[model samples]
Target: MSVLDQKQTHKYSMKPESAPVFKNLSSDLPSGLVVFLVALPLCLGISLASGAPLLAGIIAGVVGGLVVSVLSGSQLSVSGPAAGLTVIVLNGIAKVETFQAFQLAVVLAGILQLVLGFLKAGIIGHYFPSGVIKGMLAAIGLTLILKQIPHFLGADKDFFGEMEFFQFDGRNTFSEMAYAFQHIEKGALIIGVLSLLLIMGWDNPRLKRFAFFKFVPSALIAVLVALGLNYFFKLNLPALTVGQEHLVQLPQMDTWQKLVNQLSLPDWRALQNPDVYILAVTIAIIASLETLLSVEAVDRIDPLKRVTPTNRELKAQGVGNFISGMLGGLPMTAVIVRSSANINAGGKTKASAFTHGVLLLFSVLFLSPFLNQIPLSALAAILLVVGFKLTKPSLYLNQFKLGWEQFIPFFVTVVAILFTDLLVGISIGLAIGVFFILKANYKTPYFFHTEKHKQGEVIRLQLSENVTFLNKASILLTLHHLPDNTEVIVDGSKSTFIDYDVLDAIQSFKVNAKERNIRVHLQDIPEVISTNAH
Candidate 1:
């Protein structure tokens, strides 16, 4: 199918009115399992990237699924240690001497988010331009694909979730790809190729209709198949065998005492250090932006067309992050990948989200042994697909067709992220977007569309709905350059608030009209007493 057709299909699936069985446990259970399967690899990979303890990602996943889901107003969106914040987390960790101190930062960030939620800062999410948001989404998608390539090839030194141009090693993104080719392990390459092929086949339209396939996530099936192959055939084809180094590794803890010993402790002393507060504010703002964006995307795919309460979602995320940090988890956000999987899997309600969390908790507590055997190559393959879905060509084409006003910022963001980090790229995109906003405003404070009348030329100046001091230059420029003996009508009928600067300019021009032979008429405009009147 064409991209347009695929988009239409998604839109059709999301019309919430069509699906009335939101409480169907049968559907939600299976769907939640699928989301859990997807979240596992992502959580681990992101934690790896953040330089946090391996268990920290799992902690974020559990809290996201269990704590945040319950508190969130979003019935469908899922939360976890997102790739978008991986770089920020790593940088924050660097700023503080220990991971424990970073956890303290996460706690502070959560508190900030709570304050923002109460302040109703969620409305600000709506103010972000659509072009910038799409740019961000696309940039993240491309970053995922680029960062996962080395992992897929079993070059596991670099973090699978790193979005920056530079790697943990000194190499940049393309340089890492070159190194991966030179150091490719035969066994890993075979597994990666096969697993990727499996993903492609699983995406086939004809095969998904089977009842069994309908219940099982394609990613889970592919991972299981890869694991079975590695476990059974590792001895025979050494070249194709996935080593323990290339498989999932979880710390073995048989009892509650052992697990408690493994958990890291946050340094309360770090709270008194003012530097921690700076990191806290940064994490809170960036994490909130990422979460709000994911919520926006997930709401689009929601079967019920339900609108998520952004403020409530922020509060829920705040609570979750605070708890996660207390327990030594990395920062968290509403991640679009797992959320999309949940929606696509026919997840019915928040139960699917809650269930996914329970499943993560269960896996860490009881099933880590089995999970540790899954090859990293398999997860990398799955992420490759997830990445492709986000930066699809169709999304680019759609934006390009919208004109340069949208496409320029979108393309710039993608390029910026490719060369820099997520936060930096997004900042560049926002800066460019703001420039466009100002550019439009520079021309729009007042209407300058002139018309010819029987008596020479007539100029009608209609002030915009909200004219601020920014409009002063344009208004004055028009007034100062008016032709002699021209009739000018200044209309403020549609404006609710006109700045004093603008009113003063108009009143000054009215007084100067006597010398210039200009005829001036004001409509619903307030007069400013000008010194020129004296």
Candidate 2:
């Protein structure tokens, strides 16, 4: 089928009844397994960055996968605790003191999300300009590039937690790169380079066709290879070493009973702190925005071209977040990485997401020791690829072609995100984008399509639909430029709605007609208004 045909087929074929039950279930199970692998380290890493208990991340992943998958309206979208929210959560934890208090704020945030979903606030996502969304993706991509450099170079002193343009360490992403060259760890760099090469080689067309490697994920292969190299070559290269400090160090649980004992509850005392309220509100807004953005991104990539119910997504996410918080977990949202992995793994339903959660639970319970052995640098390599994908040069080129209106906002958003934090950068970019749109509309002629009549040189100027105060300047300019001794006919036939200010402007133009030796005429106007002359 042609691309257009495929798109239409995908779009029209998306009915719940039409979904292949058995086939989807089978495909999703394995797909979920893949997503589980991708999500595991990320969940732990993000949780650590957020200053929350490592178990909290696993709990959020499980809840997000299991609970949110069942409740969400999206078929292939995956939900989990996001690195995007780590900074916010970290700050929230610092302000709220005890982790229990932070849990209360998370619960409140969940409640707020639930309310937003019920109120159909997800519609807000629909209104975001396509340009701005593209820009956001680009900015996120740039951030990934900047932040991953230190990891690639084995520089851990500058914490991975920082996403701002300028760091507290008095360096930006670029400056860090400059510093990294001089103080590069040979072991980490070699391993990172080898991991990257292996990943790139796995994607080579000829190699991908090989039966043995075809089904294996490049990330898994890279990790295994790195581990083998670490063991065999005994490369004591400092840069190559996946530092113990950088790895996922799960809290030592002596037994299954001890693990269960680590579970926590929200502190009611946190509710008393005003900072908790602030943090809750911030979480609600940022989480909502991130979810909305991810939904959009996922939809773009979906082969089925299915449109997800945004409100239902919000409600599902709320429930997930609430449950996660109650169980001592970080905040959760529908993330693009695992979602894309699900699709790439041929996931066709929510079962994939649920299965991923199940797999995560199993890994945590049974494979904790093995998981801990996987180097942090190896996982960092995975994220490094993710980051590169987000900020690729192709994305920048694509945004530029979308026109200046889109490009400017997108560039600004990227720059803002690079310099500031995610929320602040997105806000600034969104504000600027909205302003440009309004300004563009303001410059458009309020009245269009003029025709001159021979009898009295009567010029009929037709007003377009939805005229507002912003069009006043255009209208006035047109009127003021009209030659003297001309008969002016104001036509409102096409105008469905006109603001009072526009009507006032028209009335003023009529009053001033005699002074310019112009005769005014009105056509297709409402009888009630036409009869009551100003």
lDDT of 1: 0.79
Which one is best on TM-score?
1
lDDT of 2: 0.76
Model 2: residues >4 Å from true position, as ranges?
1-34, 158-162, 168-170, 207-212, 233-240, 252-256, 269-275, 337-349, 451-456, 468-473, 499-501, 504-522, 525-534
**What is candidate 1's CA lDDT for residue 342?**
80
lDDT of 1 by residue, 1-534 (tens): 435334433443435423543546677788788788778877887888788898899899999998998778777889989887887888888888789999999999999999998887876666667787777777777877877777788776765456678767899988998887777776666677788898688767788778666666676777788888886667677667777777777666667677677677789999888879999999899999888877876776577777677777788899998999999999999987788778766787877888999988788778889988887777778767777877899999999999998999889988887898766887898789888877765665444344544445778877778877777877787677777888889888887887777677788888889798888888877544223322
What TM-score would each prediction reach against the true structure? Answer: 0.86, 0.85
- Per-candidate local distance difference test: 0.79, 0.76
